[model samples]
Target: MHEMLGNQYFLIRNYFEAEKEFEVGLLSDPDNFKIKKKLIVCYIQTGHVDSALTLFHNIVSTDPKIITDTNPEEDNCPCPEIIYELESILNNSEVELKTLSLAMLWLYCDLEESIWYFEQYYQFNKSTHIIKSILASLNKEINK
Candidate 1:
């Protein structure tokens, strides 16, 4: 119930309110991966990148323990299905989702996909120099 409301608020662009709901959901079910992921997204949407990054790092770090034969660090990025879901959200009016997706791609040095998402984000929200600079750097790297 709380999770659903929180996610609804997030989709409606009410990040602060969504954060509260997600925080409550987290308190109730600390190990719910879906809730955790949505909380991370809410953090990112609200410009709480440190929190989001911490969560991302933790998820990646812990995956190896759950899947014995898998080397989480070697993967170098979140699962492709996660990426596709995020990218699909980005294709919607979720500009913050696009930003986070691009940031993840950039963090992974996924130059090609980063450039694609960044271009789409830039087209929608042209106010940020940070994203533009990232796009420029990625473009330069791709060209090189």
Candidate 2:
């Protein structure tokens, strides 16, 4: 009910009130991806790119497979829009989106991002050999 009200407010361009309602919904349902997605959308709609990115990272990190087989309904799946918007912001170019699309050919589509994360991990602990090995395998797969 609260989510629906928030979504309604969002559709009517009342972002501030929508955010309040969504926040309240989140208070009750911390694990509700649906409400989280709505909140993120409200942020984006309000030009809160940083907030949206934070939410995007949270969602991506926690749920690597944002689009699973169980949720076939469009209303339940905000992943497509989330991915599209993030790709636009992250890449901001036709060429870059093309590159990202190619990179997502195999694996979980966020594998490219994982590679970036692994590089950061390597920087912190150069002696950890597993990260490098997995990176090499992923690189080989990406290149092929």
Best by TM-score: 1
Report the lDDT of model 1 for residue 144.
Answer: 62
Candidate 2 global Cα RMSD: 8.3
Once model 1 is optimally superposed onto the true structure by TM-score, how far is the C-alpha of residue 13 displaced, in angstroms? 2.5
Give the alpha-carbon lDDT of every model: 0.60, 0.55
lDDT of 1 by residue, 26-99 (tens): 88888766666656656765768667756654543454122222232453223344556666676577576556
- The window of 10 residues in a row where model 1 has the poorest summed lDDT is 64-73
Count of residue pairs whose backbone atoms collide, per candidate: 0, 0
Q: For residues 1-144, could you state the per-residue lDDT of candidate 2 as single tens digits? A: 787898788666577889889889888888887666567656755656456545544654565354122242444333344456555565455443333222222123346664665565466567855546655755654465
Give per-model TM-scores.
0.47, 0.46
Model 1 residue 108 distance off true place after TM-score fit, in angstroms? 12
Model 1: how far is 136 from its true place, Å? Answer: 25
Candidate 2 error regions (>4 Å): 11-13, 67-144
